[model samples]
Target: MVTANKKKIGLLMVLPAIILFIIMTIYPFAYMIYASFTDLDLSKANTGKIIGLRNYLDIFKDQLAISSIEFTALMVLIAVPVEMVLGLALSYLIRNLIGEKILRALFLIPMMVPAAVGGFGWKMLFNFIFGPVNYFLNLFGIQSIEWFGRPGSARIAVLIVEIWQWAPFVFLILYAALQALPRDILDAGKVDGAGGWKLFLHIELPLLRPIFYVTLLLRVIDVLRTFDIVYMTTYGGPGSATSTWSFYAYKVTVSYGWNIGYGSALCVILIIVSAILINTLTKVLNIGRELGLSKE
Candidate 1:
């Protein structure tokens, strides 16, 4: 009776949170899905009529939207792998170094900064005339290049800012994972004439695989929804060259278009794409079972 009562009490305590989740997250998502198929223009008198898949079809027909989606994909492809590799390499190299804790705190500075602030700061550093990046290039007798002038250069500029800001985040997670690895297995490998690359590849890499699955998923999702840096630094300039999905959606909804219907549609597509990628990655990595995080 006591156990049953305690269970009931626990359920009662969690009821409010479950209700709030439905209200805040579930309902909104359901509504957004519905809105995506409607002509939900706030500016229009006749709106919210179900149109069914026209919005989805229009996404492909729109060049700017397609370009933005492509740019976002490119960013994810380039940034996630680079961050993963760079982070893992740095963590492995310095896991046993002197003042490791201090180095960790220092490394986390970029990730800790507010995204908007960091973006604006980077904008100044990349300024063509007197920015420190160009100033240093001038010192080396190289001409200062406009970071955001051309399509290709603008994309690279956004990428550099993204990689710089988020690489440390990957490093932080992997570095901790490295520190927590079982010393017994490592010692056994060393005793068995396994040293350096052999020991890491066979033993350490396997142990780190579970954590990598989590980190890569998170990093990819974050990149997919990228907005702050592009908004602050480039403003989707040089003829919308560096625009992202999130940025484009905002532009449609509020910036100039005021087409909430199309914006919602854009969001729905993004949500669908995100879901597909996440599901594929989870299955491919088998993260749940590998991490002992799933019940069945």
Candidate 2:
């Protein structure tokens, strides 16, 4: 009876938090799912009529949606690998440095900066008139390049800013993992003829695999949900060149039009895509083991 009462008490203590989670997260998600199946216009807030799967079907035919998905994919493909490689290299270099701790802290400054500030800073730096980038180009007799005024340049600018802001996060995670590595195993490798590139490729890389997968999974989700930078810098401008899926959904619902139902559908699609990609990556990496899920 005492054990049963103790269990009941424990359950009672957790019940409030569970209720709050249902209220805050589960309820909104359920509502959004319901709204996606209806013509829920903000203008006519309460008069939505069910439309079945029409919104889902229409999403494929929407050109901007297609473009946004394509652009987002391109950014993920380009940015994630570059960040991972750079982060790993930097961690390796810094690991052997005298001031590794201070340098690591300094590297985190960019990641600590607010996204709005970082985006605006990059935007100003890339400006054509009186911007440092253009001034530097002028010194070499090259004309000023309109970074955000052209579609291709705008995409490049966004990618550069994103890579700058996020690479440090990847570095921090990988660096911590590197530090936690078994020195005995590494020393053993060195004794056997593994040092430099051979040591890293054969020993370090394998140990770092789990952390790398975790970083990749996180970066992929973050890239897909990229918004503030695009909003503050490109606004998906220069003719939809930098429009990510999140920004496209914003344009559909709040900015360009007030199609709440369609926007909800877009959000649902985004959630589904993110979940699918994360699930695939988790399986490929066997992340459950890394996370200690297999232990229990």
Candidate 3:
């Protein structure tokens, strides 16, 4: 009875946070779902009358919307894998090396800085004129390039910035997982004449699988909804070169006058995509448990 009373008090203490989550997250999401089925454009003082599935249909038919989705998908495909691979390599190197405390801190500096500052810093690095990158290129007799003025270059620039900012997170997580690995197993492998590459491939890599997937899923969701870095550097410019769904939505709602209904529809679609990805990941992890590969 005493334990039960303590549990009740603990629940009461957390109730305020639960209530706020419902009010701030659940309520706004529900409201967006309702708003998505309306015709709430600017220049009209209406709360938007219901327009059924027209907004969704139009979204599918809109070339710009299709293009933005494709661009975002492509970015996730490229940036996430590269970041993961680089981060894993860094983690492994640090794990096996001496005097790593400073190196680890240096790696994490990128993640610690503000996103806007990092984005602008990268932008300056790739600037066509008076930038260190161009100056280095000129040393090899290579022509100066317009990094953000072209579509291809703009995409490349944003991908670089994303990789730089988020790769540190992957490294940090993987390093923690490495520390938690069974020391006896690694020591036994070392004694059995296992080379570094072979040991990593046949042992360490398998053990790191769960962490890898978790990191991959997290980075995918983050990159999909990414806006600030791209917005600060390119503003989705050069003919919608680096335009992601989030940036496009912001443009339609805030910058280009209010199309609250359409913007809300975009938000709904993004929510649906995120939900689907989360559910799929959950199923994958459940399968891992059923196969005796991972803990719940």
Candidate 4:
């Protein structure tokens, strides 16, 4: 009876936050769904007559929307895998080092740096006329290239900036997982003459499976929503090359015009995609029960 009363009190304590979430997140999302099916525009104070599924259908046909989706997919595919692999390797290297603590702190510097600042720094680094990147290229007798002025180069630039900023997060997570492995199994492997590749393949990699999958899912989800670095560096340009869905959504709401309905539609699509990703990941991890328990 006492436990039940305590639980009820705890639930009551969190009721305000739950109400705020409903107001802020749930209400806005519900409004977006309603607005998406209308001809809502800012000039009309975001009021409009119902238009059915026209906006959604129009979204499918929009070249900019399609391009943004493709770019977002490519970014996730490229950045997440590369970062996970690199971070895992870095984690392994640092795990047994003499000054691992200090080294881990140093590695987190990239993540600590502000996103806009990091983007601008990379922008300068990739500049054609005066950047050191071009200077280095010249040393190799290669022509100076305008990195962000070209579509392919712009994509690469954004990818690099993203990888630079977020790789440490992957490293930290994987390193923690690695550190938590059973020492007994590792010792047994050593006794069985397992030195490097064989030991990792047979033992460590298998143990790291859950962490790898979780990290992959998280990074993929995050990369899908990438905006700030790309925004600061490219502004979704050199002809919409670096535009992800988030940037495209921003353009719809703010830059191109204030088509609130269209922006709301785009946001709805993003939310759907994110929901699907999260659901798929949760199914794969089978952590739903554990997550529920943690909430208690």
* Cα lDDT tens digits for candidate 3, 1-296: 57988999999999999999999999988888888899888767865899999988999997778878988988888999999999999998986467799899999999999988898898899999988988999999999989999999888888988999999999999988888989899899999988689998988888888778878888888988999987889989788878899988898788876888888898889878978976797687664664466677
TM-scores of the candidates in the order shown: 0.92, 0.93, 0.91, 0.89
Q: What stretches of model 1 exceed 4 Å from their correct place?
A: 2-13, 292-296
Answer with 1 or 3, whichever has the higher TM-score.
Answer: 1
TM-score of 3: 0.91
lDDT of each: 0.91, 0.92, 0.87, 0.88
Clashing residue pairs, backbone N/CA/C < 3 A, model 4? none
Candidate 4 lDDT over residue span 1-296, tens digit each? 57988999999999999999999989988898998988887766647889888888999999999999999989878998899988999988897789989999999999999998898899999988999999999999999988999999899989988998999999999899988999999999999999787888899988887778778778888898898998889999988888999999999988888788888899889989988977887777765443443342
Task: List candidate 3 segments past 4 Å from native.
Answer: 2-15, 281-296
- lDDT at position 28, candidate 2: 93
* Residue-wise C-alpha lDDT for candidate 2, range 1-296, written one tens digit per residue: 56988999999999999999999999999998998999988777565899999899999999889989999999889998999988998888897789888999999999999998998998899999978989999999999999999999899899999999999999999999989999999999999999998999999989998889889999999999999999999999888889999999999889978888899999999999999989988887789887777763
- The better candidate by lDDT, 2 or 4, is 2
Task: Kindly list the per-residue Cα lDDT of model 1 for residues 53-159, writing each as its tens digit.
Answer: 99989999999999999999999889889999989988888766899888888888999999899999999998988799999999999998899898998899999
Which should have the higher TM-score, number 1 or number 2?
A: 2
Please give the lDDT score at residue 219 for candidate 1: 95
lDDT value, candidate 1, whole model: 0.91
